[model samples]
Target: MQYFTICAMEDTDLSSDSDLDALINCTLLYAATKFKRKKRIWKSSYLRKRETHGEFRLTSEFSDDQFTNYFRMNRMQFEEVHNTIQNKIYHEGSRAHKEITTKEKLAVFLRYLASGNSYKSIGYSYRLGDRTVSKIVNEVSAAIWECLQQTFLPDPTEELWKQIAKEFEQRWQFPHCVGSIDGKHIVVKKPAKSGSSYFNYKHTCSIVLMATVDANYKFITVDIGSMGRFSDGNIFSSSILYKKIQNKTLKLPEPDMISGGEKELPYVFVGDEAFPLLENLMRPYPKRKVTANYENKVFNYRLSRARQTVECAFGILAGRFHVFRKPFEIKLASVDNVVKAACVLHNYLRMTSTATNVEDIADEELLSDQLTSIRYNNSRNSRNAFLVRENYTHYFNTTGAVQWQRDSILRGKY
Candidate 1:
């Protein structure tokens, strides 16, 4: 009930010396203070008595039970917990990422991500061998992916789908919308034998990651094995998504909003022009003149609103993993795992953060233009809009495309 405050260390930061001895000693105290729930703890110089032969040492006045009850540790017990996390929790075989503990590994990774530090620089700071530092980072990153994929992503259940449907109505004014689908390229170090196969519009050789994010900006699906040289269109057509659509294996719920309609409405997913048009897939109509003025703009506007989640999700991923910002210079096979880990960590951070709400974007032409521009650039290979047109044609046949036509008219149709 009471908050306790006191400095555990003095002002000189003597606890942060380069020696391993310092790490052992300081980590012990850090674990002790943290375990005790002490709010203020310091590590620095302790004043010495000039009259004494030895430097003066002050006893920390703690409750007699503080050792057993508060710290829950004896000297041996403290070392065991410290060793467990150091050896087990963050022990990625990667030489780049090794540190004292999982917490330390996370700190290093976040620091590297937040500030683009060279491996040598990070190694120097963490007192790890340079090569060891690289392995540490990669291994720790893999662990993050393992944890997140296991904890966060699962096939959405009916309840989850319903929640997604509700969010679409409130946030994007598009009912029955489950998630936004898109692909992003991550720059990577060019492999020895690979050539134009990895080259992308960004003028970099990289891997492409396809993702589906729900209205809340959480990834619901992911496929991350294709080369960056592949167009989003090719990635989509060749992906498991296309297979699922073909096999009818993707079990989707019927939208309640369309329950009363006589039309044979199936569950729908939204994507850009790069993805194949299917009965369940909805994309913008091919660039066409609006017979009903504004209809084209309105449809594009609505589609853009629903599709923004994938863009934001990618932004968060890239911003949080600088490894993605720079092309990786590792083995090509390892690239998939790194991309997978970055995405999983991204979802993990989003779930753990206090800010759970997706950023609200204003409905402005400038924002639309920016989104359109990025899409065009990313989808340049699929410039013909073949997939989008195919889907629109199918939907037109099914719903008579009349309601869509009417809606287009009311909105000055696209």
Candidate 2:
């Protein structure tokens, strides 16, 4: 379609300077009709019937399994998310068009995250424009984070830390372990002129998602959106969580005795080799060191079991949401909030879900090395750090020893 702006002008010849000036100065006719460039058919037949086939239709008409398959959550879970954020995402309608319902906006947002499809493709399925779909994604993602973070993913309290430690001991037999910390690379399109800032060693543009997870695969605290070019240790060291822990401002519980141990030991977080060894953080012994002795192998095995909580969390996240399975194809500005919203939603679904296995959003769908093996250059730490680790090592090989740990380590499981 073509467009023309029509106006009334004095009768004049193009050859004359006066006529040219008159043409340039002529006022646009107030009553003149201007043609606008628009699609000849604004809504196609398929588009008009989108309500019968789009996510709305699927979410409403599909059976429980089908519903979960499409949206990555059951209807009850989806409604919980909708009810929490509907008001925030809601907009008043004007004469031009009826406001998009919060439910529809959420459907659009979920389709984008659940499938990692392009906005244009999602818009096509929803009978909306690509720009509108993009807007909905950003708006709904913001609402998901702001409305849900406090309730679903609150910062850990001192009491909560103690509970986490107890659970870690009970569940994984790793006493005094508070939480598991790790980082995952969330790939994205490189921002314009960002240089190598977001370029990772894997040769992809990405951002880091650093999370501390509790025993039940729930995120206790999370920090994301750092450039992927940064190492895991650098991201951990620079994060506010690290700062708080180092300054003793996070109010971690005081040292306490384990079931069979006489000495009080500081509660600690479990991480892979990518993190520093500190009095309050335990990482695996180096491969060479672990091979040298039985005690080192036992400690590494115990810590690896405890640290897999975050790995399982990331696995379920990438499996159910699927957005993290590839580079996020949304706007760069929206990537952080999108990831934040997913983390918040993961917490919510975990609490609400009773579903099991591959079809379940809460299942521990552990990914292979792809999501778990991002490592950094190892650096040694303090003498006190070594002492703290040795205390745990001694406990694990002796009183903290489980029947299967030694066998598992001898089988080269660590």
Candidate 3:
């Protein structure tokens, strides 16, 4: 009985040791797992803290002048834009527990637009990732376009069109001229899988900006995002402006008497030879090898002088916003937004600033004087168009003639 009692005691001792060993192993495993989880949490928190604190903090330190210099806008302008886009860029911070402020986003985006810096470079300056910089830029650009379109680039009514025509006739000395139309190639990086669709005659990848400018160098109408491979005529025909004019939905003014009521003249937009000569559009006469002293030549010279407005508008846009001067590395949609935003901002700046000199920003040399032969469809309509041109030519030479026009033409100065 004593032996059996001892054996039972030994068995109880061994079972207790086995239970203790299993319990100790379980505790060690739990401790290791807890440590690993804490380490992970600590790492994430450190990274988040680092990301939240950086050069972006310095934005608050800039003075008004510094802000204007950096963002290319005065404080009032900045606030206006920021307030307009604040709701669009605001982040609720629900999932990530971290977010960028709306003001900071605008600042970052404006800096990118003003400087045309690479995403990585902008990220470095703003203490953001390149992806974040790119996202903010695109969002802010799109927001600017959406929020300011109606205010800056509203559709013109008949009175406004007539006013523009009057301005052209008074300032440019081109009677019945409504606006100047032109096209420019905005260079861009080749898009993926685009093949040669974006390749232009200049042997570069680009998108076309077809714009109509009033006498004051403001964009009256603009059509962007056309393939650069297309000619100006092709792009213009496909534009919304063309459709509106064709359908007579644009509310253009009625034909009025010209040259002291001798003949009726329709309000027209003057373009270079790359545009078609329509009932409401005029282009230069095709150059002939044997130059003649015909009225058509004088009319071409006058039309060319008026067409300078659109070219100057483009020059001012590119000069003020250097982004257009460089090849855009963004996607096509982003480029569209950027271009629209720039145009709106251009008009805004022109309307607000008193010291903006067009001569200072525009390169007069960039204006083209050479004319190309335009392809005319519909023979009867072509005859009518030529007749209209002839009437205008006669008026310019007679009743509408300026005192110095003949001298200027003789001096080869037109």
User: By lDDT, who's the top model here?
Assistant: 2
Instruction: Give the better candidate number (2 or 3) by TM-score.
Output: 2
Q: Ranking by TM-score, best first?
A: 2, 3, 1
- Tens digit of lDDT per residue, candidate 1, span 24-138? 5666766787878854332112111211221111102444444322222233443433343354354443453222445455445544554456677765555544575566567
TM-score for candidate 3, please give it.
Answer: 0.82
For candidate 2, lDDT tens digit of each residue in 1-414? Answer: 012122224356668898766565443332232323333555557665666676576567778988878887888888888998998999986664556788999988988889988888888778888898889999999999999999999877889899999899899999888899988888888888999998888888888888999999899898887888886578888888889988998879998888998678999999988899998988898888977798888888888999989988888888778777777777677998898999998888888877554634444554663353456647669898898999998898788889998789779988
> RMSD in Å for candidate 1, one decimal?
17.0
Residue 209 C-alpha lDDT in model 1: 75
Give all candidates' CA lDDT scores: 0.56, 0.82, 0.75
Candidates 1 and 2 compared: the better one by lDDT is 2
Query: How would you order the candidates by lDDT, starting with the best?
Result: 2, 3, 1
Q: Pull out the clashing pairs in model 2.
A: none
Q: Where does candidate 1 stray beyond 4 Å?
A: 1-99, 254-264, 289-296, 356-414
- Candidate 3 weakest ten by summed lDDT: 370-379
lDDT per residue for candidate 3 within 269-299, as digits (tens), equals: 8987677777888777766711676566678
> When superposed on Cα atoms, how far off is each prediction in RMSD?
17.0, 4.5, 7.0
- Per-residue error for 263 in candidate 1, Å, reads 3.2
